[model samples]
Target: MKRVFIEHIESYLPDERICNEQVEQRIRAGGFDIQAGLLEKMIGSEIRYYARNDEQVSDMAVSAAQKLLHHYPDRKIDLLIFAAASGDLIEPATVNIVQQKLGLTCPGFDLKNACNSVTNAIEIASALLLNNSYKNILIVSGEKTSDSIKYTNIEKETIKDHFAAYSFGDAGVALLLTTTTEDKGLFYQRHQTFGEHWNLCRIEGGGSMFPNDASKLVFSGDTFGLKNVIYEIAPPFVKDCIQEAGLTVNDIDLICTHQVSKDTYRMVAETLSYDVNKIMQTFHLYGNTAATSVPIAYQQSLLDGRLQKGNIVMLLGMAAGINISVQLMKV
Candidate 1:
């Protein structure tokens, strides 16, 4: 079998930077008393990137992919896979726009399994590499959650959800996966799904099932948005993925779980008996960037010099429909 390794990773965040203190102020102004330490320790976010309304999800993805290409100009790319939930437009796959924007001429498409899109795309890319179908695959994950945030509904009792409103930021990430002879590539990957939990997290508007109509112009209290569903199912799914990877919590040198929140990270880490020190978190600094979380975390690790050759790294992802995917790679 051919080994598939991430050759390069890059991330692009919006220009606006919103820190935790600012979020606290915003919350306090609305009659909430969330502590600073709680935001730091629980949400694990110091700041998050925010994009302007004009900046679409595909735009960020293109920008990140361009950065990757700039770094490795000579590298030949054979495939591209864009993964995201908050796309620029609903009908045309985001990858189509990305392909045109990036000037990439290859077999490319979009993958959507909620936040797990990137992880599942990696699994598929690895299989393609093993079969000698593609030499290099570019995986781009981007999310613009700011577009969907309903800030009008903010109150003390619903502050946690409001925290979700502020907690999620926009960002894009691109990774290059290439085939190699060394074992330092993709070692193992497992995909699992619990479709019964599909409705747990979703955007009810602008889709065929629930078309955006005049009556649906305004969101309601029970709209079933991001906050209500993600918090309910993420923790357990993280544990299940880690366990299925066939390694103890300690076996992974670095854990790059989804960038949901600090509390969710701690809860999942505690459940798996993994030390907090072993995890790489970008959510606090970058917010919950949906499909882009893992790749952004990967790039941040590279920047921090935490990821070295021969290190054992695990990529854990959980999406709506309660989909869970875990991939083990030797750096």
Candidate 2:
């Protein structure tokens, strides 16, 4: 069977930078009880980017895909997958928009399971590559989480649900994968979704259950975002992923877990008994970029020399659908 390898990866960020201090001041000056420097300590991100009003998820995705194409000019991508926690529109899947924007004639579609979208896309793409379904696959994700936030009446759930909202940031990520007969590729990949906790984190509105209606909208209170239970429920699955990969915690050279927050990842590290230093993270600089978190951190790690060729790396993630996925790759 042919193996799949990540030929190149790239990420794009908006120019607008919002730091913890800026967000805190903005929230406090509006007569909220938000404390000073609390977000930085609680979530662990110093700064994050906010997309411009005109920019949507597909726009950022096109930018990232363009960069990936430029980097690997010779390769031909036969399949395009746009995975995101948030989509651009309600109908006509967002991947269609991305495919047209990228000017790709190949087949395209979307895979969404909240934050686990990209990880699952990789799993699907790898299977296709190994089975001779497609020669080259392109996966891209763009998240505009700042657009989903509701900042009013936040004091009601101040220390509870509202706090999780402040940690969300925006970003776009692209990855190129192709068949490689060499021994280095995906050795083991595993995924499982625990729907019992599906309601733990979600956007209840703007869907079939609660269609978007201005008359029925309520913004001040939990207008649909993550809850406090995600951090509590997601850690136990890390060990299952490790065991599935046929490796112990120590065997993996670097682990690129989901970028939820500094505190969340630290708790995950402690629960799994893995070294905190070995966990690659980009949340401090980018906060939680939804499905783009793991890929962005992976790209940063490759650039910073923390991850190198022939290293065993694991990508573990948990998303808003209360889903968790772990994939182990030999780079």
Candidate 3:
């Protein structure tokens, strides 16, 4: 079987830089009194970007994909997959919009499972590449989480159910995967979803459940409840991923874990007893960018010299559907 490897990865941030204080001010502007510095103090995130009013998720995806194509001009994409926790529209799938915007003629579609969308895309793309279905696969995600922020109805007593939205930061990420001759690629990939906890974090609208309920469109979540479930399942799975790969935590060169807040990010480091330095830190700068967090970590790790060719890299994802996925690969 042919192996799949990530050829290149890139991330794009929106132009507007919004900090914690600004988030609070926006909420206050909506006729709600909110305190400054509380968001940063609670979430441990200082800054995040917001896409312009005119910019759609497709536009941001195109920006990241264009940068990727610019760096590798000779490559041809055989498949395009747009994975996102949030997308441009309600119907006709977002991937079509992305493909048309990028002027790509290849087959395209979307795969969504909250923040695990990109990770799921990678799993499907890997299978396609290994089975000789596609030579080059481009997986992209653009999350305009600012669109889901509930600036009003933020009751202080029930804040846990709505607090994750405050950390909503917009970002775009693109990843390229292709068949490689090298034996090093995916070693072990595992995924599990606890449907029982689906309500722990979710948006109540945009589906058959509430097709026309415009008021239910904003994000609703129980960050503490979600984190508690992660604390129970995620750590053990990380250990299992390492063991299944015939390695130990010390053997992995880099572990890129998706984190929503500073506290959840630290839990990974603390639970696994792994070096905090080995994991990429993006929460402080980008917050939880939905599905883009892991790929953003991948690109940043490469830029910071923590990742190199032939290194064992692990991608750990924790998403809202209470989904958790771990992929061990060599790059």
Candidate 4:
């Protein structure tokens, strides 16, 4: 099996910035009794971006891809994978639209695993590259969660449970994975799903189970869009993933946990007895970008000099499928 190396990576954040101060004011103006500094203390996101109303999910994805494509003008994309919970349409795969926008002739498709979509694509791309099926694979994700936000109906008591929903913002990320002769790319990857907890967090109205229609329509907060209930179930998976990769918490140089919230990842680190400083965070600045969070953080680490070549990095992603996935990579 050939190794897969990430040749290039980039992210696209819309110019629209929404600061915590604005969100707090809006929530307060909505006639809800809220304590001061509670939101930032809860999620730790001071600012995040939202795509323009005219921008579709594919548009953000194409913008992100162009950055990497511009960097490597001659690189040919053999496979294009669009991984995100937010898609442009329900019929045709969103990847087709992205492929058309980029003028790529490669075969393309979509992979949906809630927030774990990108990591899942990486695992699949690695296998394809190892089997000599494709030389290079491009994974693109555009998450426009702002479209689903429900701002009208709110009860003061239940709103606290839905605070995580407000933490989500819009962003896109692109990753180019090419075949490498060296054996130092992905060392270990593991994914576990708890179907019983699937109802903990989800968009109930968009799929076949609920159907997208006016009569059955539901708002993001009304459904379980951002409600998290896997706090106790997640720690065991994190420990197992490290052990499965033949590594311990101390062996990892950088750990990029999903940018869900400051409290969420902080609890994860404390639960695993891992060093809090080892975790690279973007939730404080960009909020939760869904599938793009890990890649966005990974790219930021590269720019900030926290992640480097040959560094052992661990990526932890948990999503609405009640899914927990971890990837141990040698960058």
lDDT of each: 0.75, 0.79, 0.87, 0.82
Off by over 4 Å in 4: 28-36, 212-229
Clash-forming residue pairs, model 3: 310-331
C-alpha lDDT of candidate 3 relative to the true structure: 0.87
Q: Best-fitting candidate, measured by TM-score?
A: 3
Task: Assess the local accuracy of residue 13 in candidate 3 as a C-alpha lDDT between 0 and 100.
Answer: 98
Least accurate 10 contiguous residues by lDDT in model 2: 215-224
Evaluate model 2: give its lDDT: 0.79
Summarize candidate 4's per-residue lDDT along 69-121 as a digit string, tens digits: 99889888899999998999997999999999999999999999999999999
Query: Which candidate has the highest lDDT of all?
Result: 3
Preferred candidate (lDDT higher): 3 or 4: 3
**For model 3, where is the 10-residue window of minimal lDDT?**
152-161
Summarize candidate 3's per-residue lDDT along 1-331 as a digit string, tens digits.
4578888898899999988888889889877787777887788856899999999999988899999999888778999999998788877889999999998999999999889999999999999988889999999999998888888776778666778888878999999998777777776788998788988888888888998998789888777878888899888987987888789899988889897888765788899998888888888888779999999988888898887778999899988877889998887
TM-score of 1: 0.85
| Runs off by more than 4 Å, candidate 2 | 29-31, 157-159, 214-236
Q: How many backbone clashes does candidate 2 have?
A: 1
